[model samples]
Target: MPCDACATAAGDPTGAEFLTTKSRLLRLLAPLLAAALVAACSTRAPLPAAPPAATPAPAPAPTGPLTGQPAPNKSRWVPVAWSELPGFDADALHEAWNAWLRSCERPAPAFVPLCGDVRRLSIASGEEQRAWMVERLQPYRVESLEGTSDGLLTGYFEPFLEAARQPGNGFDVPLYRPPADLTTRRPWYTRQQIDTLPEARAQLAGRAIAWVRDPVAALVLHIQGSGRLAVREADGSTRLVRVAFAGTNDQPYKSVGRWLLDQGLVRDATWPGISAWTQANPQRVQEMLWANPRYVFFREEPLDALDAAFGPRGAQGVPLTPGRSIAVDRLSIPYGTPVWLASSGPTAQLSRLVLAQDTGSAIVGAVRADYFTGWGEQAGDVAGRLKQNLRLWALWPK
Candidate 1:
C-alpha cells in the first residue's frame, strides 16, 4: 500500500490544509483590520458606510458526543451519533477486540495514546468496551464528496490445500518463489508466457517452493494471495506452512470468472461455479486460465501452532482477525482506523465493527471494502458468494 507521502505525491488534490492555513491567517488579520476601522472612523469626516456584507451562517457544531474531521481526498466524514450506528448495541464487541488489538500493533499516531486502553479493555465486558469507545472515539459516517453513503462490499479468505515437497505423485503443478531477476524485470512474464514459453520456464526452473495436485487449487491460492499448504515431506510426515504473496507478474488481474460469464460458459461466477465449469470443459481449462494475465508468486513461512490461530499479516503489518478484518482503500480510510461496517445480502447480514487492516488492488473507492472471511472451504464458499451493498462509519479519535 502507498504511504501518505506517496499518496500526496501521486497527485490527489485536496484543499483542506490550505483552507486551514487560510482560516488561521484570517483570524490573525481580524484584530489589525478592526483597529484600522476604528482609526478611520475617528480621523475621517462622517461619511456614509457601505452596506455590511451578509455573513453566511456557520454550520452547526455536531452534538451528542460526536465530532468531525477532514477525511482523505474524494471523501468527507459526517459526524454521527452513536445511536445512528445500526446494531451497535447488539454486536458482540469482544469478538472485534482481537482485531482492535492487532491495529494497536501499528497504531496510527492519533490512536497511539489509546492503545493501552484498548489492550486493557480486551478482557473487559462488551458493554464496558462499548462504553469506553463512546467516551474516547467519535463515529464519522464515511461518504463521498457527493454524499453517497452506500457502496459495495465483497469477501476474501485464506485457502488451505494439500501439497507435495517435490513435483511427483500427481502434484505436477508447481508454486514458485519470485524468480531471481524479478526486481530487474519490469514484468517477468505473463501467465500464458510462463506456461508455454521455454525461456520463462527456464527462469522458474528451480524456484518451486511446493507442488500442488490441481491447477485450479493453485489458481485459487494465487487469487487469494496466500494459503496454508499441508506439504507431504520426504519422511512420510506432513508439515503445514504458509505460502504468502511475494510479488506479482506485474500484469493486470483479469477475473477468469468474468471471462467465463462474458463467454456465456457459466451463469454463476463464484469459485464453485468456475470449478464446475472447468470440470465439465476440461479441454478448455488452459483457455479459461489464460483469460487472466497476472501470476502471483509466494514465499513459504512456518505456520507454528500459535501462528495458525490467526490469519496472515495484512498490509498493516499485523495478523488479521477473521470476520473482523477488512481491506480498504488507503486513500479512503487509513490502516488502523476502526470502522463500523453494515451490509445485508444473500450470503450474510452483518452489522459489526471491523478494522481497516489490509488493502487489495481491487478495493478502491470512498465506501468500498472487502471483508476477510477465515480460511477453509466454508469461508471460501461465503467469500465466493459475498457481493453486497455496504455502509461504513469510521470510529476516529476525538
Candidate 2:
C-alpha cells in the first residue's frame, strides 16, 4: 500500500477506493464507474495485488439494488464541477492521441505498452476530451450521451444507482470483444526490453494480476508516463515527490517479486528467476537490486520522492489491496462499508489500496475517486500502460 500522504487535502481533488471482488457489480462499484468516467488521471505507477471483498448489492435483485435498505443520503456526485470542467478540446486531444498511435508503429522502449491493434475507439459522453478521442481515435466515432445514461456504466451513476443497475455497454468496447483477445498476443509487445531488470521482469510477470493486452503496450505506456516529461510539483509540496505513473497490477505477483529481486533489495525467493538465471541470464541484467515494504508504491509526494531519491527508476513497489486499505465516501458507502464490484469490462489490476479517499480534481462525485500510484518512471510506465475492464463489490461490515 502507498505510504501516508495526506489524502489530497480532502475536498481539493477527491480520492476513492474500488475494493471489490472478481464477481458481479456492487454498490461500491458505482463509485468506480464514476471515477472511470470522469477522473482526470495525471500519471500512474504499477498496481499491487487483489484484496478482500467489500459492499452490499446482490446481483439477483430482480428490479435492482434499490428497495434494499436505503443508503445514507450523501451529497450527489458531479464529475468535474461545471466550473472546473474546462471547455472540451477535441482538437488538442485528438492530436496527442494520434501521436500516441503513431508512436506504436515503431519499436518501443523497454517499459512501454504497445497499441498494435487499437481497433475502433468510441469514447462517447462523460469522456473528458470527446473531440480528441474522436479525432485521434479515427475510423471509430464518438457518441454524445447527453440526456440518457444507458450504457453499461449508466445505472451506476448517482441518480441511477438508486433505481437499479443499468445494463449498458461495459467499458469503452461493448459489442467488440476481439476473438483471441488482446492478452494472448505478447509477441506484438516489447519483450525482454529491460535487459538489466530480469529480477524485476520475473517479479512482475509472475507477480501482478494479469491485465495487459501485450507486453509492448504495457512497456510503452509505462515509459511514456514518466520518461522525459516535465515534472509538475504540487504547490508548496517541494518535500513531496508526486509519483505520476505507477504500473498496473495486471501481471501476477510473481512478476512483482522478480522486480524486487532486480532491485537488489531482496533475493530471488520465488525460484523462477533463479531458474531462468541458471539457464542464461539476460544481458545487462542487474543482480544487486533490493526491495522492501517501506519502498512500496507511494501516493504522497515526500515519501515517493524519498523512495525515488534512493530507489530504482522505471520500477515500482507493491500496490494497495482493495478491501484492506480502502477509504470511501460515507454518504455513498459508509466508512466501513463492504461492497461488491462488477462492471462488464476486462480486468482492473489496480493498486495496493483502493482508497475511497477524497479527491480535489474534476472527479469528485459521490461515486468517484482518484488512484494513487507511486512516483517516478517505473510508476509512470505502469500507470500509463493500463487499459482494462473492472467490476467491484463491497462486503458488509465485518
**250: Cα error in model 2, Å:** 37
Q: 361 in model 1: Cα distance from truth in Å?
A: 0.9
lDDT of each: 0.73, 0.25
Clashes of 1: 0
The clash numbers for all candidates, in the given order, read 0, 130
- lDDT tens per residue, model 1, 288-341: 888878888988998865566677888999987778888888888888999998
**Looking at candidate 2, what is the lDDT of residue 103?**
27
After TM-score superposition, the amount by which residue 43's alpha carbon in candidate 1 deviates from its true location, in angstroms, is 77
Residue 323, candidate 2: alpha-carbon lDDT? 20
Q: How much does candidate 2 score in TM-score?
A: 0.23
lDDT of 1 at 218: 75
Q: Kindly list the per-residue Cα lDDT of model 2 for residues 78-167, writing each as its tens digit.
A: 121111111222112332232233323331231032243221331323244443322222110111223221111110000000110111
Model 2 per-residue lDDT at 14: 11
Q: What TM-scores do the predictions have? A: 0.83, 0.23
